[model samples]
Target: MNDNSSRPLRLGTRRSKLAMAQSGQVAQAVQQLTGRPVELVEITTYGDVSRESLAQIGGTGVFVSALRDALLAGEIDFAVHSLKDLPTKQPEDLALAAIPPREDPRDVLVARDGLTFETLPEGSRIGTGSPRRMAQLNAWARELGKEIETVPIRGNIDTRIGFVTKGELDAVVLAAAGLSRIGRSAEVSQFLEPDAVLPAPGQGALAIECAMTNAPLAATLAELDDPYTRVAVTAERSLLAALEAGCSAPVGALADLSPSPDEQIVTEMRLRGVVGTTDGKTLVQLSITGPVPSSSEEAVAMGHELAAAMLDKGAAGLMGERAL
Candidate 1:
């Protein structure tokens, strides 16, 4: 560890409970590894201040720009973010220093009175604001010949859960990782498998960002980087980048690392792209698989190829419409 006894490393984070919890974990890790004190600074972001819908507020960058501005201004030494909330592009001065071990990268169904998907009544109301989730749920419901209504719901995890508990909605879909981080995993009525609901890119992972010039601090963060998580998330993000999809785009991807007998890890990834009308009446989804990419560039290329295939099949037209 570099001798920085004079100044503690300042860690910037959003004020949300989950964000604080994740930042606390990272601060603790850095403190242990570097033998330095870490200071937590709560920063308010546009996403927190604006009442506008996420898509209306300009996609996912609202949550990240403030924290990134602080980093660039040297107001904080590092920052933590929910990887899924990050945009596909990175700023010139900032570097994604680390991707720690990922949590469960699956969406969960939370329903009132412990009801599972199979048991929910016909015409039951589900709540979620994600176009990706809405599309998948609609497609699956169609396959089952089940008539269910998806209601647009948005807020923090607690607020979203309240919709179900308060009898406003029969169920809601949320990231299993978010629930688990907040110690509310028990609220999950069912863990939707990847085969049924592919997760958004970089879900369940935490991103550490720091200024590119901060070599010493960046090196310290490197200790926390999990290679498996990095590779998997890299591929997923690459796919997102290739598609030119923002965080709100109806794109999902999951990557798995299968180790070969020769002790080499083979990267395998599946990408799912969806396009849907605003009313959720029609949707087109495409899935593609390829060998794990050797680099972020390669992974991005694979994602681009898959996206091109989907577009050729008229995905662009479907996405052009509003998705509620």
Candidate 2:
């Protein structure tokens, strides 16, 4: 324990409802563990202020850099972020002290009428800002021999859903976990299966970051880290790193860990990754299964290997294209 009870734990978070909800959860956990009060410090990020498309905003770091700045400057003792928003490359001075257990890492389609993808009308307007979701949805539409339009939309979950409710869009794609965490799961019309729509790397997970020198704070955060979740997200993040892709790139990956009944204590993990064109015209996906890695480094290596296999099959060119 740091024995700094006089100073409350300062938690930095974005102002979005989802971000607040997630950060609040982490704050509650820390308070429970340390029996100390925690204060949440809201930080507005570029992603929150920019009306320009994500690609124009310099991709992955938009949502995270501000928080990192706060952490480095001691404006806050630590910060929490959606792991998916974090860049694959971490800053050297900051440490990812904890990755709490992951949530459902699947994309969900929210429609006004509870309509599934197949049941949607022809030429339906689907809203999403994620190139990865757009790519998958378009690809699936193509396979089904249906014409669909993907509209560029951005906002927090509620605002995005408003498009559908207001009849501007027939449906929208969002991460299932985000909706679930904010008690908006009822808005989800269909949970897109992983095979149909792989999630962005590190989706549905939270990252707790603190200064590298804050060993005491880091040690406390370690108590919140779930080993299985850490291993799985580590592998997925590693794959993203190997592809040299930013968070906004059309990249999706997921790793699942399951306890082996035969081995009693051993667990097996299956990792899946994809790189695709923003327009859904091309894609390369790969999957691998192995025993859960004992260390974060090993898990990351597995992800890299899977990404390399996909790249060898022409994933690079697809991932390199400009967002549509």
Which model scores highest in lDDT? 2
Candidate 1 displacement at residue 14 in angstroms: 0.6
Per-residue accuracy of model 2 over 1-324 as CA lDDT, tens digit each: 245687799999999999999999999999998787899999999999999978667577899999999988889989999999888888899989999988998999998789999999999999999888888899999989998999988898989999999999999999999998999998889999999999988899999999998998899989999888888888998898888888888889989777777766757899999888877889897899998899988998899889889989998888753322
Error of 1 at 113 (Å): 1.4
Q: Record all residue pairs in model 1 with backbone atoms less than 3 Å apart, i.e. clashing.
A: 267-292, 278-322
Output the lDDT of residue 133, model 2: 87
Looking at candidate 2, the ten consecutive residues that score lowest on lDDT are 315-324
* TM-scores of all candidate predictions against the true structure: 0.92, 0.96
| Model 1 lDDT per residue over 1-324, tens place | 234676898999999988988899999999998888999999999998887766676566889999999998889999999999998778888989999999999999999989987788899999987877877787777777788898877788999999998999999999999898889998899999877777888999999999999988898898899877876787777666655667776667777666566856654656565555544567666777777666777767766777778677777666532222
